[model samples]
Target: MSTDNTLPIEHLRWDAASARGPRELNADATAAVTDPGAGRWAFAVADGVGDNPAAAAAARTAADAAVGAATSDPRGAIMVAREALADAPDTGDCVLVVAVGGAGDRCEIAWVGDCRAYLWAEGTLRQVTEDHTLAAYFRARNLPVAPGMEHVVTTSVRTAAAELIGTADVPLPAGRLLLCSDGVHKTLPTARLRTILERAADPGGAVTDLVDTAHRLGGQDNATALVVDRTAEHTANSSAA
Candidate 1:
């Protein structure tokens, strides 16, 4: 009898980048939190209402609160974030997307407002969450969307009802997961975003390319990008080779 002795390596990885762009203050925030020994993690991105003086605070608060829920509780995390916001109106309002997963094949995603979550697989990028905006609402009914109405958000961390929160369960290990603010998506077209992600060497590289791409393209708002990878780049490269 022969005994095999090759132990598998474990690696959990994610990266994020934030830039002020043309704004005086960065109203965007990102968080990557882990629950040690629990085999679960959380990643979030928030876009603060630009008009509010406390927009940055709101963005940070929402992200921190959501990730602190300790595991992959997407909807419950959003609820915790909302309640946290309700307790501190001075922080203003923000839109957010939270993804909870680990080195697993699936993730739970929840969002309020326009922050977005996307999955990239084999050079294809698919948006996993919908924008809770008036534009989306009107377009859903086949109604003509007016100019600028697309920016009007229907729900947010500070104002969303329980039913207004959007939730999803997406396959993660088959690809990479991305959470980004509107600054990234609005400034970079879907094609451009996909190209950047496809060219990135890894999740950290992807974060830099995505955020810098938006800024270099003359973004008018704060930008943020968070990317999570279930598989190590070296492992994938080895398999490919």
Candidate 2:
């Protein structure tokens, strides 16, 4: 949130965690890249479904492929990720989010499952992805609230089929882009997340705060967060002024 204009191609911050009661390594991974001379960059995060062993592998594989594909075809990155997952023998679930083309000041985000992407600007937090969850479905149906609601997952990469693919392209306004897994979201309320994002000095610190907060609040699953900060590039002509 520092208004420092000299920070080059903005800064991206991230964080991740596992379930609260202790578990194996967090089934999540992320990647970030900034083309030295191009001023363009990519940031991505993947969350593997817990119910399937193959989900973790699929998630990591998809993330790697997405980042690599973004270098040439940013839009194709999602397709590449999807195809890669399909080829893998893992029917597990995964979620992906990426931002590229800094020069054009555009961001491309894609995802599957409940993992989410958010944009923070003007002191407001807006969720960019609709959760593919049973709770979301029920809410959409205007169904009455019921107990054990949290147990239902209407949509996820791990669900029977790969039906949760979605994409969004938006202008990267001067603010921040946040990508996170369900572990962090399940534990911390959105308001708290907003406060942390707004207050953190940089992306790294923000991601750390988000993960730490989830752990303190009883992280019941693997938690992860990725932050990308965007600002206008200062050209020599502009700097001379």
C-alpha-based local distance difference test score of model 1: 0.81
Candidate 1, which ten residues in sequence have the lowest lDDT sum?
1-10
Among the numbered candidates, top lDDT falls to: 1
lDDT of every model, 2 decimals? 0.81, 0.67
lDDT of 1 at 52: 54
Please report how far candidate 2 places residue 9 from its true position, in Å: 4.7
TM-score of 1: 0.89
Cα lDDT tens digits, model 2, 1-241, are 2212234543333333334235465677776556646555666777776745676686788777777777545446767777777787645657666556555556777666677888887788888877767677788889975745654556444333433566677666667788887778778899999999899887778888898888888876777888776643432323344
Give me the overall lDDT of model 2.
0.67
